[model samples]
Target chain A: MKPARAAWLFLAPALLVLGVFFLLPVLGALGLSFTDYDLYALADLHRLRFVALGNYWALLHRPAFWAALGHTFYFVAVGVPLSLAASLGAALLLASPLARCRAFFRTALFAPVVTTAVAMAVVWRYLFNTQYGWANHVLGAIGIHPVDWLGDPHWAMPTIILFAVWKNFGYNMIILLAGLQAIPRELYEAARLDGASAWRQFRHISLPLLGPTLLMVTILTVSGYFQLFAEPYVMTEGGPLESTTSVLYLMYEDGFKWWNLGTAAAEAFLLFLVMFAATLALLRWPRRSGA
Target chain B: MMPRLARALVNGLLLGGALVALFPLAWMLAVSCMPPGTANTLPPPLWPAHPTLDNYRQLFAHAGMWRYLGNSFLISGAITLLSLTCNLLAGYAFAKLRFAGRERLFRSLLGLLVVPAQVAMLPLFLLFKYTGLVDSYAGVVLPGAATVLGIFLVRQYAQGLPDALLEAARIDGASELRIFTTIVLPLLRPVIATLAILTFLAAWNDFMWPLIELTGQDHYTLPLGLAAMAREHTAGTESLMAGSVLTVLPVLLLFLSMQKYYLEGLLLGGVKG
Candidate 1:
């Protein structure tokens, strides 16, 4: 066979899988979104009705969809910064000259990133258990009363946020640590010669140099945080009156549990648009501000 | 004196952070070993007084954890093998082959990355149901058999291989298939290891899709099984921890052993792409 034909032969298997499974279904979801494809329609194609943009409009009016959106925003808004701060803080410490056994600490911190979310969430559920859990036990010892972490609606999302940060921060920690190592030692030495304090040196030298890495990390973390499903599903079950119900969790329920494929497709698209817009805003902000 | 104090403070903070990071996992192991109902006691014993295998025994014999473990291993192993083969072929072709639409096709693949996998999942379920694949191993494994990231990673690595090597092979009258299997496969060992571990860990830890696709208890992966168990046995803290340990231990060990390649793949996927 010619090289071109050979190449096509090589590509055929992957293309077939990706095309049939990924691309085709993505297009199908778009078509499904325009129709009322619930359980009845799922059972009988004759029951399906064409409704252009109706799914989107119906989701817009639904309280659960809006509430899930608010919760997702709440997650991204709070979880991103907190996760970044934790990651940056840990990376800074590990990068410090005085830090000992850097590899051990790095691995320990990154361990959570490798474990299954459902498994760890299960452990976390017990750790934050109301009466017998370690979290409240420690809090009670410190003269603070035991607060319900996953039980109360007001506290459930926050608890999930905490779990998410713990679960994810280490990943960015590794990336930030790599960025930290790439900074020149000479720069730090020159700053020290100029009598620049550690904090000032970090602000002027480290932060400015690490800007690109930080931006990439932020974008990746933001997108990942938006897909907040397993944590709530495993830990809170969108509990205490749907406080932890994320947009993805709502989609899973609508699409899988309730078989409301049309509305679920709309939910997925809205999430995609939101994430796309957020990523675009992040990319454009730097250029627009001339930073 | 001030430097000494600062050093101590930094060490203290690092130690504290490590403790926080590891305490939950350590506690899981501890509770898993403890006798039943011991975790619910006042003060919640940090270590088992007399560690026993009863909970683990209970997990395997009573909770049907072994079935889920077998399912997880089979599904993840199959995905890793099939995905690696498919991705390697396509990645190598995209890198070195003379083909029309290679660049355009690759760019389009990259574009598809932005459309989250969840977008395809709903319709994919209906498609699977129509094809009689829902609740089958094929349903879980086939969709994951070729990921954009897998192809991208392999292509990135394959692009680094010398063109002259392949050219020499072609001049020697070797077919592309022979060249790929004998020369390219061996050359791509490092990346193959990385991709295999990444895919295995991902498939093992995956929850949502398996939870959706594998509806029956018999077909459930470990995560799905554990989630189901968690719902039914909410108050059985010790038994739940045992289940959690079983679900997490294999992947944790795999990650720990191959962390170098695993971290390399992470940076490769994140930084370059």
Candidate 2:
């Protein structure tokens, strides 16, 4: 049999699945977003009005949409940097020669990455409880007042951010650890021969070589941080005056709960647009700065 | 002496980080074993006053958690098996076969990664609804059954296979399917392990798609059930913690057992890709 023909046969099933289930629905979303496809449209095709861009237009005017967008951006802007720093810090520590019980520490750090987000979020909610949580308990011991973690709008997002950092930093830590390991020990030795300090060696030798890996990790982490749904959903239910309401959480409510399919599709597309632009900017920034 | 101080500082920070990472999970375990309302007390007890299985009993007996557990296992297992086959075949073909437009097709698929899955989700839900798959396991499993990342992972690993070996097998008048099953499959064991672990873990921990698709209580996965249970009974702290323990334990154990393959897949998918 022809290899090409056999290849086509092998590819057929997966391509069919991807096309029908994933790619086609993406196009379908674009179509849905142009109209007011809602619970009314679901019952009868006659009610489906083709109001081109109307959904997007209304979303632009909706203050709730703006607020959700604001909260999501806040999460990405703050969460991404904090997450990266923590991951890099942990990776550096683990990569140190003096570190002991390396395997146990590595697994322990990475454990939270595997646990179900909803389950961990539940645990986190209990831990941050104003009355009974360990967080306030530790604070009280330090002579600080117990703060309402999930109930106060100002504190809710920060608490969620902390949870996000703890849950996620390990994943990137593993990647960055691999990155650090890949850098040759000879370079550091050479730097030391030139009387370079540890910080200077990291600044000059390690940082430059780890640039590509760092950028890649940052891009992946940034895109993932944008899709902040399950945390807000399980932890606060987008409560505390909706301070933790991410764009994806809003999309879930608008599309799934209210059956505002058109508006939700529009919101989904806008999110895609923002994420795409962000990724492109990340890709271009290093090049533009002549790095 | 100076180096000793630095070493101590580094190890101390690592110990602190690991403690922070593992504390919540440990607390969840401790809280789940506490008697009802024990966890809600002041200065939250680190250890239960009297450890008991009451919360687990309530979870299984009253909350009907067993059903959701079964559902999660069934769906995740099916997805892992199904998607592994799909991704393996396609990935091997792209790497080794002489198909027209193979590179272009693979590149286009990679390009699709930039478009968030949520963009397709609303319409995908509608499509599933129209096809009567909304509440079924198929709706949850089918979309996930063949992923671009899975294919990419497999293809990257498969590209290293010696073409001479494949050629020799083909010269022996072996059928393509036979060559794949008998010759390629064994050699692809490492990647197969990686992809299977990745897929099963993702499926088990998946929340959003299942949350949307599985509308009925009977079809609910563990994450969905936990979320619903969390919302409905916020006061049932002990049982909720028990439910969370059940939901997290399987995948946590799987990950611990297969850390090497899982971490390898992450680097492959994230850094290399």
Judging by lDDT against the true structure, name the best candidate: 2
Model 1, chain B only, scores a TM-score of 0.97
Off by over 4 Å in 2: none
* Candidate 1 per-residue lDDT over residues B1-273, each given as its tens digit: 389998998889999999999999999999999988888999889999999989999889887888999999999999999999899999999999988778999999989988888899999899989999999999999999898899999999999999999999999999999999999999999999999999999999998888889989999999998998887765488888899999999999999999999998988888842
Model 1 pairs whose backbones collide: none
Error at A137, model 1, angstroms: 0.6
Q: Which ten residues in a row are the worst by lDDT in model 1 chain A?
A: A282-291
Clashing pairs in 2: none
Relative to the true structure, how large is the alpha-carbon lDDT of every model? 0.92, 0.93
lDDT of 1 by residue, A1-291 (tens): 578989999899999999999999999989999999999998899999999999999998999999999999999999999999999999999999999998899899999999999999999999999999999999999899998999898999988999989999999988988999999999999999999998998999889888899999999899899999999998988887999999999999998889899999999999999999999998887788676
Candidates 1 onward: DockQ, in order: 0.82, 0.88
Using TM-score as the measure, the top candidate is 2
Q: Positional deviation of A204 in candidate 1, in angstroms?
A: 1.2
